[model samples]
Target: MPPSLRVSQRRLRPGSRVAIVSPSFGAPGLFPHVHDLAMQRLQSELQLIPVEYSTTRQVGATPRERAADLNAAFSDASIEAIMATIGGDDQITVLPFLDSDMIAKNPKPFFGYSDNTNLLNYLWNLGISSYHGGSTMAHVARPGGLHPLSTSSLCAALFSGGDFELYPVSEFSEDEQNWNDAAWSDPNGPPPSPLQTSAGWHWHQPDRVITGPSWGGNLEILDWNLAANRWIRNNPADYSGCVLLLETSEEMPSAAYVFRTLRNAGERGLLAQFPAVLIARPKASNIEIQPTPEQRMQYRQEQREAILKAFAYYNPDTMIVFDVDFGHTDPQWILPYGGMITVNGPQRQIIAHFG
Candidate 1:
């Protein structure tokens, strides 16, 4: 394996300065209350200073404008790391304007997921590793407080570069509180969305261990990137031995769509490159479509089946673990993008190697 496949040893120390830019969406502009609280936590809890760019709070900022913020952040020597405020749908548009040469010359740890996957893959292709799950507005400014799991994993990713074992959440939530609602601005903030008892992770073909650099994110965004055929390596073999990380966004794509997306990758001979796969707990419900508890279970089961079918057809020997919390789900775990991840099938465990 190439040495650049893993993240560099660079890490943020206490009092480090991090650039908080909205490379995807100017969410801080949309909800200043949520953004402000997140900034406060970034300082008080993490003991890091937050630096915002011009486009950080400018709603409807152009793709070039967003890309410029990212370029500026990466070029700035004082900024130890860069983090996105939130993910949005149009991040793909910003890719064309990014100054890859400038970014490659001055690499910094980036943190975000969902649409941020586009940037993550771009960085990965450049041999720069990033965090796959984080959003200043979503996690740091979470109502009530940050999830213990999120705080721990994020802290590990940011400061401690070591092997970190992932634990399943016994209870989790996928519902979202309306950020536009007045409750978000209240002194107490809005109550946390209810959590459902986790069914625990389900492992398939737990016969061996597979450890390699991580790849893939938000399945939907990956499909878009795959179709663009720009960021992904031209040869599928470039991904051989990598662990696949997949999760669905709040858009809640249907089982058929998920199957088709994976199937597309399979047809391209890309899916077979991964020896192991870690799937995030699917977001079973959204604010618009709240399924009953029973229905939610059914939905998850169907999606699981779709995934198994696709992988079974493409690579029967591949190991799969379902329902690991990350991405759109509550209490997200910050996994390393392009960093080492060990999927131990026999032990039924997942460990992320930070840095």
Candidate 2:
């Protein structure tokens, strides 16, 4: 890791330019209204100007073109930061075309998650820290303005550089909000569905505090990395002392599938490398699935057990916390990928350093 990477971390002043690129699915091209809403909020709330690249709104762009757009954003002297518009299923395909040397030479904060995990991991491997949340369409363009939790956390990551504690939102919604219709564009949209009271963090091996640089991303994406033989370290020992960040996508793979994925990681000697693990709240259901409440509860419980089963078999002494709201959940926190993270088990808390 180069000390120069930290030199790349700069707090953006209001009206500073941020590059908006779609390295994943080009949802922004399909829903221009949604993209416009997000751009408006970035300008009005953050006072930042969004400069869209050619491939940003290009739905059928080749991987090379999107990778070229990313290269352009990182290398540009005027662009202070980079943000993904949304996550897609095939972002893994874009990894090979990225220039690791160029990205490392011109490191800057990158913000995104889900399928954008591919990009986050790519930056992490280059020894550059990035943000693991805040896709423009899903978060910045959220109904009824930005959610308070997401806004506050994102602001801290963008404007300041230090240790920030992460906490549970008092309530979070899994509302059946439709994004394509006019209902989504209305600032005075109908009230969000009732928020479920948080169950709070569930812990295992809550004893010592472990602090280190963070690693890991979406579980499905990590699995893809392993299968593709890309990005993942050849030596498991390379991950020692790092905090692992894991989350599921809306596809909502079955508990058995999640277990199998983790089990494969463990078998590959990956799970034992980290002393702390953060699992995002499993998106128990989606509009396509529309599971019953009882079914949702059972699904989450089973998934939790599956994760615990994997850890127990591999790294039993690790500090594990479940249901973190950073992935596929409402009011997401923007975690700093490859940045310092403190997991205080005895105190039951997690702190991350954006710088």
Candidate 3:
């Protein structure tokens, strides 16, 4: 597709009636208390109405219903934007049920990450822009108050247009405060964990500012897309001039797996096409498999090495930034997929231009 044809032009505004749909999982609606809080925050903080759909709370609903909810949100003139309730493990299932025409025509902002990467990449394939951050249940309406950085970045993504810089949050949190906890019911729970002072963004190949349309999402979820051959362009060159932002989920795939995935991308000629890659900080802990500090550091090191090796093999000149705050980590930065991104590696700065 031509560059102009692949871009969506709508920009979100305040007072937009945003639809909250569960395209993947319905955790929010299943726990109405948390979902309701998210809705409340959307209204009070953003001055946006949150419209919920049937599938938003309906666990085990067919992908058809989820697709219908997406269609409804886009088709509704009143709904200026759409946000996912949370990510799931099977968003790929919803692909067949989607109405590409509706999504292409409406072209409003859609916000999600992780499994929602399925929909984001799908929209990108349809030549529509989308956001890769902020879900109702996970980030916006956490048990404790939302992270300041997450909230700030989300607001900027929803309301602002044009070039916007993303800074490292002074403090960050990755604590998985459970939704089942009564504290979630309280709009304000115990104070969020103190953010450790930021060490600032790390840059590699810091030479010049590379600007391009943004692409990529939860790294593990994207592998599913590769398997299905669903949303990616057939030609690797189709991704040329794009800035790829990737992150791992809470599942924390083994470092070997990360390297292997990158190796596969390199083999496919995908790694060499992008001008830059912004890798989000990997989630280091999970309920089932918590790693010690040493183990976590080792994991990060291995993954980093794997990424470097793949880049060296495929695109040695590509710019890269490690540990950007997006994806499964707290203080997530909202990124606009298919929208413009500026990576000023020489200046150690990143700007996501959305409108």
Best by lDDT: 1
Q: What would the per-residue lDDT of candidate 2 be over residues 1-355, giving only the tens digit for each residue?
A: 2122242757988978999999988888888888888998899889999999998998988888999999899999999999999999888888788887888789888899999989888887777888899999888987677888888889988887777899977777765566766786575344565577778888888899998888888999988988998888888887888899999988888889999999999998888988999999888767667777788789889999999999999999888999989998787988888888898999999998776
In model 3, which regions exceed 4 Å deviation?
A: 1-14, 193-198
Regions more than 4 Å wrong, model 2: 1-7, 188-190
In TM-score terms, candidate 3 sits at: 0.95
lDDT ranking, best first:
1, 2, 3
Give all candidates' CA lDDT scores. 0.89, 0.85, 0.81
TM-score of each: 0.97, 0.96, 0.95
The sequence of per-residue lDDT tens digits that candidate 1 reaches over residues 294-318 is 9988989999999999999999999
Model 2: lDDT to the true structure? 0.85
Best by TM-score: 1
